[model samples]
Target: MKKMPVALMLAATVFAGVATYTVPAQAATNSVVKPELDEGMVKLEVYFSSYPPNNYSDENTGFNGWLVGVTPLPNGQYKGTYYGYMY
Candidate 1:
């Protein structure tokens, strides 16, 4: 009976060690690239608690915008970008 407890404790310690060793490697693999804008263009970034909304009304305001990308952040928010060219 005592052997069973000792074996379980050993297994947990080994698992914890493996988890700590691999976390940094996993984080390094996921890197975000910076967005680039070209001449005669503009970039706008916004954050949302959920998915971004459609920009159909932007045309009426003369922006003619569209979603460039949407990245989900670690803090339960979304980071989105809009790229548009003005008239």
Candidate 2:
């Protein structure tokens, strides 16, 4: 009877080991997106930056400015927040 318990425990251990090895670990990947605007659309040509922004000023002689970051979602849509102000 004791042998039966030992065998069961050994089987359980082996099963657990197999499960751990066979199941692959999954990781999520996130990518950042940058937005572009027509140069003539808005006068804020300078602020149309990429993922890591560098400039936050309008090329034209204007006070309007914008700072934004965009990320693509799994639903095939973009998700992000924006902050616009006049400088």
Candidate 3:
């Protein structure tokens, strides 16, 4: 009985140690770019001169722009809009 408890505790300790082990995180070296527009996809370009209250503007251009892609649904019945911002 004593040996059985000792063996079970040892097995539990080993499992706990393995569960706590983790790989170190790494920093990305390459930048991620958006995918190219496919056929039948619609693109919308938006430019902003000034917002409001604070009147925020892009530091480099004094304005900002966004590119939105609208893709057709898989069912071919509707379209879905996707937007992403990268700074």
Candidate 4:
């Protein structure tokens, strides 16, 4: 009966270790807009929270969705994210 408890504890530890070591692969959230520039320029980046609209209406423009822009600081030291909408 005591052996059963020890086996359970060992199984739990193994399971926890496996869970900690495994990481699920996920798609990147943002992508660099300009990677060619190396110095003195705040790199621009853009990312979409959701897939842009595929269909367009007469009154509404297509590709209306959440758009995020990473703007470089004027000092060229840091970057900031600006959220905007389309349509």
The candidate that achieves the highest lDDT relative to the unseen native structure: 1
The candidate that wins on TM-score is 1
Worst 10 residues of 3 by lDDT: 23-32
lDDT of 2 by residue, 31-68 (tens): 24335554443423221223424234444644443434
The window of 10 residues in a row where model 4 has the poorest summed lDDT is 61-70
* lDDT values for all models: 0.64, 0.44, 0.38, 0.38
Cα deviation of 46, candidate 3, in Å? 30
**Tens digit per residue, CA lDDT, model 1, 1-87:** 445688899999999999888754213322244346678877766688976653412555566555656778999997767776666
Model 2: how far is 36 from its true place, Å? Answer: 35
lDDT of model 3, residue 11: 94
RMSD of each: 11.8, 14.2, 15.9, 12.2
Q: Which residue pairs collide in model 3, if any?
A: none
Instruction: Give stretches of model 2 more than 4 Å off.
Output: 1-4, 26-87
